[model samples]
Target: MLSRARLIQRLVIFAIFSFLLFVGSQRIPLRSNTVPSAPSAPSPARDSSYERQVQFWKNLHNLLESNSPATDPPERLKKAENVLFDPNANYTRPDLFAISEGDVKQLQQVHQRVVQKIKNDNSSLELVYHRGKRGIVSAAGRKYLPTLVISLRLLRRSGTRFPVEVFIASQEQYDEVVCEQILPTMNAVCIVLSGILGTNVVSRLEPFQLKSFAMLFSSFEQLLWLDASCFPIHDAIEIFQSKPFTHVGLVTWPDFWSSDPSRFFNTIASKPEPPVSERASTDGGQLLISKKTHAKTLLLASYYNYYGETHFYLLLSQSDVGGSDKETYLAAASVLDEPFYAVNEPIRSIGHRNANGHLDSSATVQYSPTEDYKLTNQGINHVKDANAGPIPHAFFLRTSYSKMSPVNLFDPSRNGSEEVSPIRGPDGKPSRAWTAEKETIDSLGGPDVEREYWSHVRWTVCTLEGLQFKDWKDKEGTCQQAKEYFDAVFAPKDRR
Candidate 1:
């Protein structure tokens, strides 16, 4: 997690970079000499005419699909030019990213290796990248990777599953992120959704458009959206529950949007009066979205988050933009009244509707009864480290729970073990661990060194003095205890 002040500063910087890129993309000449590098067995991204034009001319280009092997391909712009120019576009809105020094190199090397793997391969299932997504987000010079790309990269690198049919407003940024890091991790590819940011009202958005775009991609009803940040924490399946989308579900909480109105988009949203119904809570971060089945609600939610700029500013003014994706999503839900079923206890559903046309939110549209879910629940810990998404199912959906799996770390005792042991390798001297362990005190969300103790301690134990992992098997060291340790190390003078 990042502090408000530091996140604000970095976002300001990245926003500048994105703005420059956006401007450059629209204004620069698409020189024919500029070619997007294509690797063998490519995913057809760079090979597409739209990509060709984008690479050569930093100008706005449309992606055109071809039916014939030979002859002139028809030029079709997937995203509208006017949409990009709309100051009201949702891309500028708030969302979410950084860290330390010696830890920077390890992250970079991991990132570079991923990038190289993608660049060298031409599989239709290659990973995606964005050109602008370079440099370490955790530490200076260390590149922070797009969670989606990194997630996919980890999946493919481990040979989990593939033929990822994702939706891209345009594959430009996708290719860019992939090219930078997390290339070899792509398996197969299929993108069948919008490629650009929707016509979201801009004034009310979070001011960080790229995050909006990324989240929109997450909402594309494609990726399983495994929770991760910069590094691949462990081995897990990308679990492309790609079966068709059956219905949309929301975690019903009692009075979440107590005082707000604004259903979703400002163009057409009412502020929350006093809330309604018995249930109204939603994870709003992790989601299992799909366009094929009955998930129009998800689409509707996307529109709210990516609508014309009018609603963007409206939403931002009322909300903190701190929860980043989660915050925006909840605000939209409060305003949109999109149909979502409540999942109180866990594992309550499993399949698609048999003779259903579309889903009726009133009746329980379930794959199975909620009583059957038996996945181990590391509830407190997992929920704490849970990735931001619409629903929280993926936390331990199919995977076994380990204490360290963010969601499972709530109990200090079950801090779970590291997947890869940080052993003193062949070179003797405790092998240097690749990590993001150190950062300037200013950046770690701390005014004083001790305030950032948790991050520091975790950083120290995970990587410093040779990478030591939290061993759940041993069932030792509680988080509270760790805090005590942190206080001792950083601020011993004022202990109570």
Candidate 2:
């Protein structure tokens, strides 16, 4: 009924409307039965490196576990012993066990005498220092001798009635200079284990093992095992009389700085659970063992050493210092579950060295005339802090100090002064001088009445012994200074 043009116009409008409707439908999203995708997970923050490290440690731990001596104790022990003591081995010493029947009879006589002495003095204490064949031949032996001399001299100076025994791996480790010249001079007994324990037993044990187990061979009731590096500054007999040593029959100072039992636990391959209440980790440098009372403890410590020897590589892997002896003792104490007294009081008896091997300054404390007496009760006077306090009764000069001559430490003429001013006085008066003369009799006297107290003695010993080493020398010309200082301080007035 419509005109043809109009009908065509209507068709065009209809087609346009249809196209608009289809676009609207496409834009409107339709609801579906399917769930919507989770908001794309924030690309998991990458931790590939951490994950890799975790995996690596896991693998390493597994490898160590597989090789543990627990798998086959007997075979491992035999193998380790053979490797350690084979006479054909370059490291083996045949002299360790070489002794004649006459020598045996003589050793027996000596043992009987020692036993008789022990019987007469049940409360007698003996100071023990052990040196292995290798240690004696190396620069370590040279360095240690001076410390031994210093320790024995200090003991004698302290008027300690107890005798000292210097135990050597063999007659070869015993230098005539030490046995004849040094020990006789100090009145110390030199016992060669080659005759006592025989080579088979002695050769398989490491120097540290010999040190820890020295109590087993001691005829005395109590043994104070001091590392060759340890120098007693105070009356060590005081330690024996202390409540911890007297009550527990075992006493050791904690690590100089750290108290984290977990850190100690990590150092042993066995990873024994730490003591529930044991906060401070023990130091082996100074240990007092009562042989009769803590017989079980000594046996336990020896057992740990045996296990450590069997798994030496694994234990070594866990060490930061390449020494596992301390960790082994710690592990033994943990497994024993018996409480041992730890001198948590700040004894400052241990001297720590910097990476450069010099004494750490911050670790040293300044002496206050009034405060020092109080501090001394806490064992603060044990180290001679430069410009701080007088020399302590005992100090642990890190083995690194052995690498350099002590004479290189300071210039006596340039650094020394006659009257050392106290950093602080009772009333905080600047005029008061810190008189070393007051403590000189207690301390090893030095060049001046001031800074040259025990440090001069330490330098003198080190310089004298260091003269033997090829690398360590008095390059600083401090040896002449030491001699002058010694003349002024220690030499008899007539001799000077």
Candidate 3:
């Protein structure tokens, strides 16, 4: 009954309204749930690899679950745990470190299963390793990310072309932006442990165990495992072709502290005690290992680490300093009678002298594994006499104090009027972070090395402020201070 013009107007308005609604819905942004898959995870090949990884974890988990003391410690072993073997006092238990015969038998069974599993997976390494066969691996959780970034940036700065894989142990440890976006720019990718192991397996994993597992899970046949704070002073890629890796397939650096593990660990491993000369403990900061050659060694190391909390860690370290996972690798190789090169060069410390005449150490400088290996084979002894060995080629500078993070480096108390470290002496000049002596500086890489190091640290602080960590509390102030310090110490004009 309405007029034709009015009816036409109503239809037009309804049609326009429907069109607007449809277009608006189309333009609406996607929630994270609907967002595209992570950049590193889109490939069908990647999906297939993940599935295989899940199966591998499951298979390994079942084997360990049945045998692990965490689930079922033998009755005698439980009783042995109650009986403390005091190293300081004479104790009658021949099985020292409180390890029982039952413990040994169980460990052996687990070892056999673990060995078989490694053999089974050796062929499938091709599938799991979506990245190249020779890549660097590091474990980085949230706490370690900033230090890791500093290391990674320095790694690339060192002119190394090898790709890297950063392993995060759980979903909790993963940072989506950093992993998916930032790392890829550095030719690195993040591998999530929980994604591969599932909740059941990941639940029981310890922080210390992640390093060995990272090496095992990494696609690379040849790997350099570096700690989050460890930085290479030279090109790391060259080590792969060098004799240290090519000859022995496994190489470890020395630590300041001697390993002095209980004699009972030898009995447990069914191997004789190592010679006094070889008792130097592993640094555990940097390692070069070939999975193709040391697959069993890696697996055994993982086993020792997995049970580290309850047994092997104490047995290996006897509660010694520098004790976490430090001894597992060499011990594993020894137990299997696998050939490996242990660096003979004594680790040296780099630091500034404090007001109290004490050295405020910052890092431990470990010599090049390749150079050390060459010297050792030539019948040179560095540990006994510094002059007897090859001229030390400083390889890794592992920061122990004063990490390269902005929060720590630019801390007001450490660098301001109330400065406490690298103190100003009577001359009223502050000592350099690494060293003050010209000869030591030249030996520890070169005159330009500290410049390179500080430049990297400056870049990390200025660029990564948006990361907004609690440690980097005053991002603006930290960045400003970092730039000023770099300008004063390492800027082009300050170059010596």
Candidate 4:
């Protein structure tokens, strides 16, 4: 009805107003005239629990820093401030720092508080993860990727329906190809340690400390933790349903040595001297724990590992062989007065003979917990005389000498034998690592586990194009050697 210019202006104003209205509708309600909603009734409890968890970690950090500040070097290692072990050499007794009575008392006080809190707090376990999930967990660095790959392949081959979570220490260790491409195919996912614990806390940890932390931060309510080099021979899901595991909700295997704790540790834990029969050091190569049952135990174990380099490692181990984070698990459970079952079976060694006449044990085989439990109840096997009866079935095989990695399996021996590959025995003979394990493997009346292990290793090195293969100097030669060795030692004997 108006003139042309006026009508055009009116239409433009209408269009602008409509466009503005659409944009306004996309945003949240305007802050003005908006009343803030009150938190739900349950929010306060959850918030309190979260705050307590945060404070617990903070307290640990402060205590550790006060006693063994990373910035200050111990007098023993004048040349190296934060480094505990030599870069090129193996960890030795000299690498340990001395702890004082005062240090022990302070640690004890903190631990006492932790115990009391768990006793008082109903929300302790629930804060970690909601109940009703189970999974397997392992930790690996970039260097250990090959071992992890082989271990995981063997795990999947064992037909475990449980999911797997592989924890890496930092962002630097995460491989996009491995994490995103390879692991998901195997029903495993990579969890970066730093992402859950934060960098400040993770920076204080070492390889020995990673395992407990992995178990703590993993989302599973029931956790089966395996070392990167350890693999199960069969499905392990039934362990959760077994009487031993269900009764205590925690199970650990035994190392060969006695595990009498240092006198000081006994005093701190307020535990009596452990009986020789019940004191077999824990072989923590693999373990099962239910967070629903032992949340306090896991938290305390994490604390032990967090302060291990300075205090608990030596306290529990007392310079025993294979001591690192191994003993902390049992120690924590014991401290919490939680019932835990330690398998009543001997840990047996398996390996082919080396150049020397003596047997060079490579991997240690652990027994099935359910079988051990049955034998114990029947009085056929006792912790005091684990070897008195027939060995329980070999459930887990943990590699020590070589971890089925291309570098360790095919490369020149680090012992300065230029021609001797790790996979071979005397005279460069193509031999299985478990040549000495034949008697035990055959006695089980099962398919050759060693052969199955090698087949997986061959598949990993020869077939899979995953990033772990990048460690191989001569991928073709390595893969060929692995295949040839398998064909020679295992293939002809593959009865299955």
Q: Which candidate is the best by TM-score?
A: 3
Q: Please say which candidate is ahead in lDDT: 2 or 4.
A: 4
User: lDDT by residue for model 3 over 1-496, one digit each (tens)?
Assistant: 9999999999999999999999998895543522123212312135555667656666555655665653233222221222222213333322334556676776656656665565566544322454437888888777677778888988888888788888787766666556655677899887776666565566776767667877877778889999999978778877889887898899998876555566656765667876434446678899998876787787778778878766677677654422378789988887777899888777777666665667666677788777777777788866666678456588887876343444656654645533443423334443357664445567776657777777777776766675555444544577777777766655566473
Best-fitting candidate, scored by lDDT? 4
Cα deviation at 342, candidate 3, in Å, is 0.9
lDDT of 4 by residue, 285-364 (tens): 99999988888787778777877876677667664433489989888888888999988777777666666656667778
- Give candidate 3 regions above 4 Å deviation: 1-47, 70-96, 99-127, 130-132, 401-404, 413-431, 436-438, 467-476, 492-496
- Give the range where candidate 2 is weakest over 10 consecutive residues by summed lDDT: 36-45
After superposing candidate 1 on the true structure, give the runs of residues whose Cα lies further than 4 Å from its correct spot: 1-142, 146-160, 163-181, 188-221, 226-245, 249-285, 293-303, 307-338, 342-496
lDDT measured at residue 26 in model 4 versus the true structure, 0 to 100: 91
> What lDDT score belongs to each candidate, Candidate 1 first?
0.30, 0.41, 0.68, 0.68
Q: In model 2, what is the error at residue 215, expressed in angstroms? A: 2.8
lDDT of 2 by residue, 179-283 (tens): 445555555655554444446656776776666444544445676666654444444566665555566666565453332222222333234444333333345
Displacement of residue 341 (Cα, Å) in model 4 is 0.3
Estimate, for each residue in 1-496, the C-alpha lDDT of model 1 and write its tens digit. Answer: 9999999999999999999999887894543322133321233344444344224212111111111112121122232111111211233322111112332343334323332332343433121333222111110001112223433443443344433433333333233323322233354332312222222322234423223334333213343333233221222232232111233433221112212222222222323333222222333323443323222333233343443232333333233223223334444444445443333322211111112322111001111112212211223221223342223232221111121232133332233332221211223222222211222112222234223323433433332112222123243444444445445444555663
Candidate 1 vs candidate 2: which has greater TM-score? 2
Segments in model 4 whose C-alpha atoms lie over 4 Å from true places? 1-104, 124-126, 321-323, 382-388, 401-403, 413-415, 418-422, 443-447, 463-476, 492-496
- RMSD to the true structure for each prediction, in A, is 24.9, 30.2, 9.1, 10.5
* Each model's backbone clash number: 99, 6, 0, 0
